[model samples]
Target: MDPYLLSRAVSELGELLRVNSAMLVTAESCTGGLLASTLTDTPGSSDWFAGSVVAYSNSVKQNVLGVPESVLEQHGAVSEACVLAMADGVIRTLGADYSVAISGVAGPSGGSPDKPVGTVWMAWAWPGGSRARLYNFQGSRDQVKHQSVVAAINGLLGAVR
Candidate 1:
């Protein structure tokens, strides 16, 4: 992991937490619990970071995060709809002020023509609304996951701002 970049991300998250004075939650899939782990790694993260859910499977996404079955069937797990649902679900379930969600095909093998291995979908949800974005990072599974976590944090910072 890039310590400098991680440090910067942590600093930015801390700043956002200080300014907005709100807590955050994370719902993760392809990036697993990396986003949550990174946030919790920082000292005093509990002041602003609420908690996280690692919804890796479709069943978990639907059952745990309340992602609609229709949305999953229509858009697939890597789609914007699923990510948005993840974000919204985390915020609603955890009662956090904001939430970030990520889903992707970060793998050495799970690459379809339409959605490649590095294809990642990220979403950020606040009190009023939420939005999702797509990213195509080029790297190995670990690298892609790292990129996804970084992007998710950046999106949260932007949303809070």
Candidate 2:
């Protein structure tokens, strides 16, 4: 993901959210806080950016984001179910009009046969509805994370409208 393009996406999203008078929040996992940081990179992001929850561990996902233990156990953290739960949790908990949640296996290790490295599940929620996507990115750790952030931002842009 080019820094310029990412900045542009952030700016575009900020503008849309501002125009709609909506707030945004995030629940992040494999991409860590990259998505949140990218959104905040633009100046005056606070107008629409609420905050983010970096739920790197299952415990945090279950506790802070209110992801169900059954969801994690049955579908794993890198599943559509978990990301959807996370998306809804962030929006409900933070009182945001829109939210994005990401969870993935982005690493040189720690990938199962079912979920290879770069397998990411991202979900975006708006006031009325939500959507989720599964991505099989091919790259190194940094590249995977970058791709996730790009996709997450793009998803937000599409959903927030």
Q: Which model scores highest in TM-score? A: 2
**What's the lDDT for candidate 2?**
0.93
Clashing pairs in 1: none
Top lDDT prediction, candidate number: 2
lDDT of 2 by residue, 1-161 (tens): 67888888889999999999999999999988998888888999999999999999999998898999999999999999999999999987888999999999998998999999989999999988999999999989999999999999999999976
lDDT of 1 by residue, 1-161 (tens): 47788778787787788677899999999988998989988888888998999999999999989999999999899999999999999887888999999999998889899999999999999888899999999989999999898888788878888
Write down the TM-score of every candidate: 0.95, 0.98
lDDT score of residue 44 within candidate 2: 99
lDDT against the true structure, per candidate, is: 0.90, 0.93
Error of 1 at 20 (Å): 2.8
Q: Provide the clashing-pair count of each candidate structure.
A: 0, 0
Q: Which pairs of residues have clashing backbones in candidate 2?
A: none
Candidate 1: how large is its RMSD? 1.3
